[model samples]
Target: MNETENDYHGYTPMDYDEDSAADEAYQTCVSYIVEHAPIERDDTVVDVGTGTGIVALELASKCDRVLGRDIDDEWLRYAREKAAERGVENVSFDHGSFREPNVEEAVDVVVASYALYMAYDEGGEGTLRAAIEGISSLNPRHLVVADKMFFGPPEPRGGYETLPRMGTVANLLADTGFTLTDVEIVSGSAGVLVASRTSG
Candidate 1:
């Protein structure tokens, strides 16, 4: 396994569940992303950085198919295990990343939570832009991003100094042909952004 896979506080696939179990904000973000993704019964949804397939599994019933992508192969394995244990057939977990989701040329919707920062926090601002643009290129009609982001003064929190700013992401989305339609601020630093494709 890659050392960077768990470098973010030694997070294993199980820890994602455990963390949400312990952090209300985290769970809120996760649930909110699934509930407000604008997924249709015939839609195909791709979830980036799908740590353990929690969101992918929950969304399978709402969409025709769900693709869960993660940089860590172990996380994908764990996600597959969860899908099997839950008898979720429409969701597939695979190796992918925020920068290269490995999805089809077009999808109905793309959703990510507690994962976007991996683009910025790990790779910096340019990577974050590429990540968002990559998702835009998928031609998904909508995007739902939920993570610990700055809603106020930009400052380090939870030991992460490069948290994405809500405004910055919104601007990038708009530049990439998406428009912000809704936002749910779970906390000062945790929130969800819902945007729709407006051009092309």
Candidate 2:
């Protein structure tokens, strides 16, 4: 997993699920990403930071397939078990990080929830740049990022070092052939960004 401001090492998969279920802002981000993303019925989607595969599983019903990639094995195991229990055959969780998302085929859309800041924490903007580029390589037409990124000035609830500003994030996406199309601020320190692939 990318270096993160908070660690999930102590929490069981069920515990993580319960906490995220209780977090209104986090839920808002997930909903906003799904609602705003330009996904088609036949599209294949890749969730770059699929912690417990929540976002990936959510998108599975709407899209043809969803591949949830994360670096955490425990989380993937739990996610897969949940998928089985729910009979969600269209979604799968596998090991991957933002910079190396092990995507074997092309995808129509890409989504990331609360993972980009961890990229920054791992190696600053440099790592984030690589992560964006990596996602771009999948040839997705649309990208949605929901995380504790700043839509305004850094807030007290977020860390200055890890909370990336929207402007910087947009510039990095632009460098990778994307145009920042829309934004939804879910809370003081959390938001969603919708970007579309565009010619440079």
Candidate 3:
């Protein structure tokens, strides 16, 4: 049992149940992405912000390989345990930011759920763009980002105010040369936006 530090929040995977609302939201978001991803058994997928590795593990069942990356490795450990318990051998984990992943190459599709909204700083827009570019640089067939979009001014939380509008992400993807192929919003839900790269 390895204990992770607080600075490594991304590594600390939150405990979730299949019956919980968060879990349900995660599944809903993932399902939409999977539907639009065009991933196959021979393709490789990467799930960013892969807390507990649920999305990654589930994806592995349908893809040839899957890598779940998080800032924290503690959650990754739990993901590994779940994978082991489920006998899912194709999924793995890494502790790092998608902005600067340590992988030697990019995978097929990048699934980022509720992660992009957390990307904020003085150069927030630039950071988000760079992160998207980093993923796009891998030449993946698809890039799926599920974020919390607000309709008005955002409330103060975790020292962040005025959350980035969902349109921001869509525009960023477009600025980075990604085509807006799909945009599906679940009524009465926070919302999950799916975008992808057009095949040349």
Candidate 4:
């Protein structure tokens, strides 16, 4: 199950069951972000590559607004539908890539859960640099990133081999002018990092 073969775009369902592992992972990532990043009520957040409103909707509950951005129209529609179903008024879904998020205002926080590394893997160096720059342009106070960590072998996922190590990710954030605040790697080989802008 190389990454190309098991890519979410190819095989993973657009939506996950309420209690499935995928849903749990989403919840776990959101929980970690909320705990470490601590969004304020007056803050606006952007959940980049937010599939099905998982992180976006959750952030909406704690912030003034949340924009869920993704390149997949189907996933965006599903996120919109889910937000409507939950009567979550502060959350909005939009079709966009992380490299060019098209957000209108400076957001207080930007979160990418299991999404940024995928952009790095698929789009290569240029995309990753663009993504970092795009996020920086938002002038976010905090940036929370959550993605898988390969401890040994490339766990059957297509691009795990290309996924940057946790330290490498931290270095990238530093290069983009963010200060690393906290980091944690879960037993499941997934990790979360929180970084803050010096001026923010």
Candidate with best lDDT? 2
Query: Which of candidates 1 and 4 reaches a greater lDDT?
Result: 1
Estimate, for each residue in 90-185, the C-alpha lDDT of model 2 and write its tens digit.
998888877788999989999988888878767878988988888888989988988877877877744445677888888998898889899888
TM-score of each: 0.91, 0.92, 0.80, 0.83
Worst ten-residue run, lDDT, model 1? 1-10
Q: What tens digits encode model 1's per-residue C-alpha lDDT throughout 55-152?
A: 88888889899988887887888989999998899999877776677886468999887878767777766878888987788888899988878888
lDDT of 1 at 187: 90
Positional deviation of 143 in candidate 2, in angstroms? 0.8
Clashing residue pairs in candidate 4, if any? 2-158, 3-157, 3-158
Of 1 and 2, the candidate ahead on lDDT is 2
lDDT of 4 by residue, 107-188 (tens): 8998888777765676665666677777778889888987765533446656344665666667778878898888776634
Separate clash counts for every candidate: 0, 0, 4, 3
Shift in Å, residue 189, candidate 2 = 1.4
Give candidate 1's error at residue 142 in angstroms. Answer: 0.4
Winner of 1 and 3 under TM-score: 1
Candidate 2: stretches off by over 4 Å: 1-9, 157-161
- Report the candidate with higher lDDT, 2 versus 4: 2
Residue 68, model 2: Cα distance from true site in angstroms: 0.7
TM-score of 2: 0.92
lDDT ranking, best first = 2, 1, 4, 3
